[model samples]
Target: MKLSDYAKSQGISYRTAWHWWKQGLLKGHQLPNGTIIIDVDSSNHIRETACIYVRVPSVEDQDDLDRQANRLTEIALAKGYGVKRVVKEVASGLNDHRKQLISLLKNADYTVLMIANKDHLTLFGSDYLIILLDQLGKKVEIIEDINNQSEDLVPEFMAALRIFSQKIYGKSMTKLQVSHLLSEFQKQFAPEEH
Candidate 1:
């Protein structure tokens, strides 16, 4: 840490931190470039903290989800981070109506989110999730880069569902069906509108 940052962390003035360093109270070093730096973790201090979020595709994969959550929690603990909570879910990452994930993202208790990868959050488009989480002042740490196995199916399924109006009902002639379907879709994924 820089001297200024360390001073801010200790809630003291920069000159006071320099005095502490000169008095041998705080550990620091002065480089040839005159840069002052402080080593903060001499007393086994652990400052990083995170919350774990795990997801799986189905109920049968609950064991895998549990293992992932436990692994992430253990990783957080090993790194001297205060583990806050281990939240697990059994749902498709492409599904936008994930109650647990929504609650976790909205939660203000933890800013760091530990997960297997972006796919564990949203197989459809995880960058959007990252943006949303950032708006909530949280960031993600992917311990393992888990690939999206069903990546191809998500878009294909959405396309099929969108064309269901014309394919199943054989009607492209009415505005009512399109409006009704749009309303249903919004209701399914945008419950906050209600």
Candidate 2:
């Protein structure tokens, strides 16, 4: 089929198909006439294998990651995906080059990479992660913790920031300290109001 027809068949826009083609993510080939042909059967090998990646910045949180990841595993397994293994990161998500994450994306065995939240994956440039996952024919699954105090995005984000900061600094933050931290985080992450 032609590229536009193939994109229509795949339920994606022609531009998206073209972007995938440029990224080498679409399983397709170019003919001598400069037309693209998609290998409809090329992606059948992508079985849903779950590989959980947990981020806990301190020894205090390290002990709890297993329980959290196990809970995530239960959800994945319930969905019929085979559990691969849980990978951990002890560094700040603001840092771009994480060893375990880099290695895992290079790996082609798993169809899914599960994490507690997008924040647990990276503090910024999450689209980059998604694009990389797409190229590798994998996906990221986020399991929100049910026990969390708030369901609202801003409060939950601030709470997560507090937890990571405590682990990074190796000390419990005072209420006032958290207030200051939240202020700075908002300044950096959220646009200033005035």
Model 1 per-residue lDDT tens digits across residues 46-127: 3555788998766656777777877887687556555667789877665688899889877777768998867778876788
Q: Mind giving the per-residue lDDT tens digits that candidate 2 earns over 1-194?
A: 57787666544357756766677766778999988877666461224777888876445456657877778866875565656667877665665677998887777777888888776777678768878887878888778675541332444455567767788886767656877988886679886578
For candidate 2, list the clashing residue pairs, or say none. none
- For each candidate in the order shown, give its overall lDDT on alpha carbons: 0.69, 0.69
Model 2 misplaced regions, further than 4 Å: 1-46, 146-194
Native-referenced Cα lDDT, model 2 = 0.69
TM-score of each: 0.53, 0.52
Q: What TM-score number comes out for model 1?
A: 0.53
Error of 2 at 95 (Å): 2.4
For candidate 1, give the lDDT of residue 32: 94
Clashes of 1: 0
